[model samples]
Target: MSTDTDRPLWLSGHMAPVPDEIDAVGLEVTGTLPDELTGRYFRNGPNPLPGNDSGHWFTGHGMIHGVRLNGGRAEWYRNRWVRTKKLADNSPFLRDDLTFDRAAVHANTHVIPHAGKILALVEVGFPYEMTPELETVGPCDFGGRLTTGMTAHPKQDPVTGELLFFGYGFMGPYLTYHRLSADGELVESRDIDVPGPTMMHDFAITENHVVWMDLPVVFDLELVNGSMPFRWDDGYGARLGVMPRHGDGPVRWFDIDPCYVFHVGNAHEDEQGRVVLDGARYSPAAFTAIWSETGGPVSEVPAADAKDPATAAASTGSARLHRWTLDPATGKATEEALDDRGVEFPTHDDTRTGHRHRYLYTEADGGAIVKYDLRTGSSTALELGADMAPGEAVFVPAEGARAEDEGWLMTIVSDRAGKGSELLVVNAADLSRTASVRLPRRVPAGFHGSWIPDA
Candidate 1:
């Protein structure tokens, strides 16, 4: 058994891993559930085994928590660990030749439904397919056409239905972009040029282009045996790349200030032909502090002062909503901070993805779900109190909806005391509570998830 002092911060409190999996039926529901929500809410996260710790919070085995709803009823709930070779047979990720066995990864970052299949995804490996019942169907490589690892945050065009994503590696071909047909076929792949390998977490999309984030946090050979093999390098400058989706033109790169963005809210081409990208941005001080506390290498820059209460609060590496406008004509970029609050997991309506969006939704570190009106420059939030921790809020459009905000936001809220968990449904227009289904167990604070409506 591990004591509190010996355990890392990721293994304790709200981020603690659950030991086993179970199922329950006929969960309790508070308030009225929308009848149109007749599908499954699947969330993927890192959950190590009972006696195992994967060194870093991001390296645990993937576990999915699923909830089924139908006809205003909470039908059932179940949790399952994604059965990968790494989890079952202790397969090595890095082979003897220094190449990676893509199947031997955690697959713990995101769970998304694309084409007709549900995939459990991690940035470093091939995606593992999962059944609607949460059973692993093994790894998928798009008929072996995907030579590189798949990104967990693939963007499916709301208009063309083609899925666009990219993969980055610590090798010569550091980055590669891929596209999937509407029928899920690997149609195109292109090698992108970059200076060095960096930890590129997420990107954005426009109607006719794909956005890329080339940040400064990079892999270190000296730290390969440590908890995380990456560290912040000030030498590698940051930039955003815009590549034409269907054209063979080279990527248009726009230099920007040094910052790290883990999640992008949305991106679109403006009337002035500038690509406007919105995301959660973290400063150097903020990233260094949070990275050190989360089992990562400490950077040369000093972390925020923990002795000062105000500075300590900012040390959580809380990312604020920021926007960047890149002009293709002038080859320049402009940035602005949209809000001052600390938030993460920025989400927008799927229908408006890669297009001009009026609203963006995010969860605050203070246990609140915030809704931002980008058009009016205002925001509203539904506070869940200090004892509740909510995961990413996924937007589900209403049936025959006309307005973009006419939808519901679904999230799994966990009790800070580890008492229990619940699936919360809130009206997107007003941030009002529509319903909440009490879960049978405490679902740990997770990464990303999706809502799959019935066909």
Candidate 2:
């Protein structure tokens, strides 16, 4: 119910949206930019317009902040608002029948370059097309072949070069799977069977199968007050589904104890044909606490006991890297905790998207970047010192990379003292800072981004 003037820290201060778009040329650089890094790094997130109210951090109008790099130089920087129909009309997206108007996309979650086009994506609406220069080009429905929304976390198969994605809605046929050809055409679309409308944010693609997370978060139309309509539904249950990548069969769902997964690191099929899925896991209690902090009202649930250890831990949305192993032959799935730290935004080498990866990158709750070695179970962290916070770290492979993790990890860092923002590039192998490009102003910490190479 609070306005932008008095919104939570996530929606105000340096995290707040800039009133107007700006462009600057020849950004200053503190160190030599990698010669191999010749592309634009763009990150998208909610940046509600002035005096506008979305009531939730996740639902604000989409804005993109980007930096262009070329020939070992920080070329330029720009920011632009994604001009969507709902945003232009200054109206809410939900209609009387609960169906979204086709162009209601906020386009704020993730930005990626695919099939010679840069796509800004939100889960509930069509992907918004943006130029390499950061100007909105309107909604892209793949030549009218795509009828459903597109997930921001689409996976491009490293081997097949096909883009694999899904969409989830509050209405029937709640989930759907889609595949795009390497040349960027909508090739396959199928309705995925699920029990109900649950919040399916992200999924995983193994070499041979597609992994689905049907968690407890469900939509509540009556709870809408200009914020996210989803709340924790304990009765909805939790499960994981595995389906063949190219086959037509029922998605085999395996029941799991109630838990929520937002982002998946990577997945693959083991030698035994068991699907291995890994990501950050949040307990039900933790989920409630985090959602509550978004400054949005949630449906009432019984309070937890103060003296209980598990209950206290759930009061904070502290997620730990967790692993799930699904044995197809036995139709069973088992999960275990990989680490006990509070982490989010887990990522790995994109080239290994559908294959087993050894290293995982995550943003620690304490404002540090951590790399976890899955094979040795060892961990390392890179601290940006005090008064500095970094957003998601995306891995960019070196030119003709030798190993999976031998490239560079890049992220936009915000200086807490209002000093300004800079792009920090770290060596993925040893977690060393390699380059820092100083921008004209502080770029707020936001959601997912990708490194699109010029070559």
Top TM-score model: 1
| TM-score of every model versus the real structure | 0.97, 0.95
Off by over 4 Å in 2: 1-6, 95-99, 299-309, 417-419
Candidate 2 backbone clash number: 0
lDDT of 2 by residue, 1-455 (tens): 86556667666655766677889999888878888899999999888888775678888788889999998999999988888887888555667887677678688899998889999999988999899888888999999998888998999999888999998877878999999999999999999988888889999999989999999888887776647878888778889999999878878999887778889999999999899999888877777767887755555532332235666555566777999999989899999899988889999998899898999999886669999999999999998775777889999988788887899999988876545888999999999989999888778768999898885
For candidate 1, the per-residue lDDT at 375 reads 95
Per residue, candidate 1 scores C-alpha lDDT tens digits across 47-78 of: 99998877888889999999999999999999
Model 2: per-residue Cα lDDT at residue 252: 90
Which residue pairs of candidate 1 clash? Answer: none
